[model samples]
Target: MSPSVAFGTDIDERTKAAEQSSTDVLTAPDVPWNLVIWNDPVNLMSYVSYVFQSYFGYSESKAHKLMMEVHKKGRSIVAHGSKEQVEQHAVAMHGFGLWATVEKAASGNETPGKGGRQRG
Candidate 1:
């Protein structure tokens, strides 16, 4: 009679642990990100305000306020969201001929809508 060889019994347990760890990583919540608009000499202030209004559906006054912030402060965090969302906003701003960039919210110098309606 041939002897039966026993394989390692912990293989399935190890696999399940590995899978749970990977799942935890995959399901982790996205970190907040900011969409920053930079002041550029090319785009007129009115155009920047217009873009803010039309694209983000901001009120005229709010748009103007943010535009002024960009003009005076040299930059403004126009919106906040997940990294992917902010990246999309950056692409749209680029399409509008605006200088825009995304950064982790924690690293940003200012928060979006410091005293106004938060746009996310």
Candidate 2:
């Protein structure tokens, strides 16, 4: 005796196929990655702003904006590019004592340290 599992009986074939494939869904577009900096108590706000200005060569005002976003928003995107470029930015942020990581962009183009502007 066994419970029934039918093809067209509400248990769709697509669900079964998805279960078989242990891969991510393909909704992600051809978007560049992002460098994200999470706020931490260790790094002073001034130093964080300075890091953005020094490493990314952002202007003083632009750096302050990104730093404020990271401070108030908990996290802010610091760079945008391919996965490799974003990862390098993350590593550099780590060197500056800021918590950082890289991930696929949520939107198409959103850069933090670069003043929320996308660079080609």
Candidate 3:
């Protein structure tokens, strides 16, 4: 008797089901991800803008806008892509001495904006 008969299951059918499950996992829907840059006291605004431009190859205007967002808001979504991509971007940002994180894009609003502060 076959092992399937011993286990009271159709071995071929079970194998097919397992294969389908594996295929489903491989072809699963794509979920967006974001690279969030957080504000810190150490870096100057010009340096942050330059990092954004040099690292992302963003234009001066765009880099300035993002830097301002980081200053006015507590954090900014600097990049968006697959989980691995965003994670890499966050790591690159950290390498540039910036605080950064990677998180799911569509799950919720991760941005926390604090009113702009006057630093004397």
Candidate 4:
């Protein structure tokens, strides 16, 4: 039998390569973005909370807390993820009649394009 087959060298080498590849993938950094929801007079608190629950799948308590934060603070960071994801969330909030925007969480700066839209 070949030395590789007799001693499981092939399996060992494959395992080492797999571990290295997984480690490289796991260590890669990702830039984050934040979806900020602004309080608006047009949306009721319950409706805002409902939107949070429905869109984000957050529990009632979590949605209510975030909604209250928006109410009291004028704005709240409702979600965080990749720029595309946060932007999508902001757009969904817009569809719900809530003022929302997405900003780069890494630099704490707003991204370009429709990220800064507000209800007129």
RMSD to the hidden true structure, all candidates: 17.7, 17.1, 17.8, 16.6
Query: Please, what is the whole-model Cα lDDT of each candidate in the order they appear?
Result: 0.66, 0.62, 0.61, 0.60
Candidates 1 and 3 compared: the better one by TM-score is 1
Task: Report the lDDT tens digits of candidate 1 across residue range 35-59.
Answer: 8899988899999998877666566
Q: Give the TM-score of candidate 3.
A: 0.63
lDDT of 2 by residue, 8-117 (tens): 45544433332222111112234367778998877999999887765665667878888999999999886666676566556656766789988888764564544344
Highest-TM-score candidate: 1
Point out the worst 10-residue segment of candidate 4 by lDDT. Answer: 111-120
Off by more than 4 A, model 1: 1-31, 107-109, 118-120
* lDDT of candidate 4 at residue 69, scale 0 to 100: 85
Worst 10 residues of 1 by lDDT: 1-10
**Which of 1 and 2 is ahead in lDDT?**
1
Name the candidate, 1 or 2, with the larger TM-score value.
1
Off by over 4 Å in 2: 1-31, 113-115, 118-120
Return the candidate ranking by lDDT, descending: 1, 2, 3, 4
In the predicted model 2, the residue pairs found to clash are none
Point to the candidate with the largest lDDT: 1
Candidate 4: stretches off by over 4 Å: 1-31, 106-120
